[model samples]
Target: MVATAETGVRRAAGTVPRPLRGTGIGWLFVTPFVVVFAVFWAGPLLVGLGMSFTDMRSTDVRNPLGVELVGLRNYLRLFDDELMRRAAVNTLVFVVTTLPLTIGLGLAAAVALNSGIARLPAAFFRLGYYLPYVTSIIGIAVAWRFLLDPEAGPVNQLLAAVGVDGPSWLADETLALPVIIVMTAWRSFGFDMIILLAALQGIPKELYEAAEVDGAGRWARFRWVTVPMLRPALLFCTVYSSIGFTQFMEEPLVMTRGGPAGATTSASLAIYNQFGSGNFGYAGAAATVLFTVIAALAFLQFRLGRSR
Candidate 1:
């Protein structure tokens, strides 16, 4: 029955209809993604983890002695092997060499982009920076190989024009790792720059205004306001770069093939060599070790970030 306003009475309040949310259609829509992730990501990760525990060679199921559990023997090999030690050293060198350039130059570019700079310069500069990243890795490697050739290369030719002889960029063991590091930095920093560009945009206008009111000079304002604000983003980028360094494979594979007397061989690339040569057990073990290192580094960074 309808209730009059004067009565201030109504039939018992009807149950509020529960809003229908997240229908089966939602799961149906995400099913493709779920399927792909399980197949490509989860499956391989599980397989790799299992492989890490076993002496699973490509040749057989690694059941030569009926049960092939090598325990930590394979993991121990990386520390004991001279070549693996060299690779680890080379990888560290690459990381240490490239980090400043990538982070510094990336932040600088981001700042420039944030500034109301001339549009044309900004566009072209961004393109020039990012082009190397999207371009084929092999193309970069091949171009660098020729450019750094001991003779008959434009880079050396320019040096000769200036009455200076360029050192063989990737030919000398002393120079090879450094060259790879530089090239990788060049190819990579653009992505970091764009990430930082977004982070710079996210900084509130009020922060700068507040700094200005405090009579903070540009550098001081940057140090106090901008840098402190950007720390979280910077930390994330650093961690990402560090992981990439751990997985350094392409530079040595194409440019040096872990050559120049193994100066540029990284743990990842060495593991790849093992897989290619049918030593999957060794590869798996090396991968497991590298994985542990990466996981630890990642956890450390996250802890540091949380503390910050």
Candidate 2:
């Protein structure tokens, strides 16, 4: 009765009123991320796209003269390079090899860990599997590089101890890429497994029980019930792993340094080398090719989702 303003009968047992400030606070909180993305991400992307049209190189900035715009010549040169072509093929093979192995093992691990069979400490087991992933990629590659040395590697030493002489893992071109593929699979699958395990837990157990009551065997139940429920998470892991495998550079760069005979140079590694070789224009063109390939892969994933 004595209030001037904003004084109504206090709510005794009713819902609290929402903030009249609306989304102002929310937008304010998100502004930092927006600004950072615009400056760092969008700014660099635009600059790189512009650099692609010019002869920008490591030493290009030292001179005051502006870079010359060579139109489509740089792009044409990339297509005409036989080494680039081989690099593309090698990259494709690596991706194809890495995706199935990583994603498949992840799915298997997720199922086991999420199932009733997980009697051990799941965190310890999960952390153990994830250890390699958390370890430095460069450090791991360096360690493995020594571990796969042609004449004096521990892997071969163990084989020699077992009366089976193992061939050089890194020096042998035939085995080098395969070894990297396996190493990458082992390191990456743990992340996917942890994510997929969380998704598996979200699925209702009643569905599985109902599935069991329907006379479905283990394999049948997994195929129809578990797999169907897991498709979304599976697709996510597949697309992520595919993109990662496709753009792999660190492994081959550190381990093989592009090969015993250029057998392990991924497209990313090639592009990186292009910069060092003062082929900035050509590198940009190849960068677009990688972007296009990744975009196509992402689009295909959407198509798969729609089909499902």
Candidate 3:
């Protein structure tokens, strides 16, 4: 009788019985991550926002209860501060100069490696390019600092051997920021290359064959097929590189100390300087500004990518 009823029900429904819905037991595995994120990431972000509005000095570390709210005065003071202005400009310069170079070089390298013309194993080439990224940033900075040293560095020595005098890279105000930009591009392009290479590989070979059948030249094929297909990956690399360049601090700190008349002081380094000078509230305000800028840029990039 039970079989008969089940058959009748299925006949009436015109389909077999559906399985029971999941009870969401799978979420139990993700609970630990949620808890950790709330405690660490979300918790400190809220605390930092609160600190940005108060007169919090480094000495008040022992007594967080003593901080007095100063409203937006710390933020307002940013406009009148010359050093802050310079830092912001320097940061903008770094982003403007580094973003295109990094993306362009990365794309070029990815294309070259993908073409299989190098006669080396592709993984070997990828690992060689990505090695600097996994290496310590401090170590890279220190090594580059010595390599760019005016008197004894190999880079300048090579230039001298060619009968051309190289400028004091980190010591010259005019050249300090550019030197950092080059070093940063060299160390960071590998990640972009890997991402772009993946995007390139995912493009269907059939499209290229069709383009060829239509009598398109190599550049024409790449322009019509490769670029459009790789749009998402390119956008990701651009936005990621922008955020990294905006937050640049370590290289300048280690290599130039933001020196040569403060030519290389980035916004992040400015915040670090404020905190080092015991002005916690001021540092927090700078951080808040940086956060706003990054958020806005990311939103803009997302909109652009979606629209495209």
On lDDT, the leading prediction is 3
| Candidate 3, 151-224: lDDT as tens digits | 88999999999999998888899999999899888888999999999999999999999999999999999999
RMSD (Cα, Å) of model 3 = 8.6
For model 3, name the residue pairs that clash. Answer: none
Worst 10 residues of 3 by lDDT: 16-25
Order of the predicted models by TM-score, top scorer first: 3, 2, 1
lDDT of 3: 0.89
Off by over 4 Å in 2: 1-19, 22-27, 63-65
lDDT per model vs. reference: 0.81, 0.82, 0.89
True-structure lDDT of candidate 1:
0.81
What root-mean-square deviation over C-alphas does model 2 reach?
A: 8.5
**Which lDDT value does model 1 have at 167?**
90
Candidate 1 off by > 4 Å: 1-27, 61-67
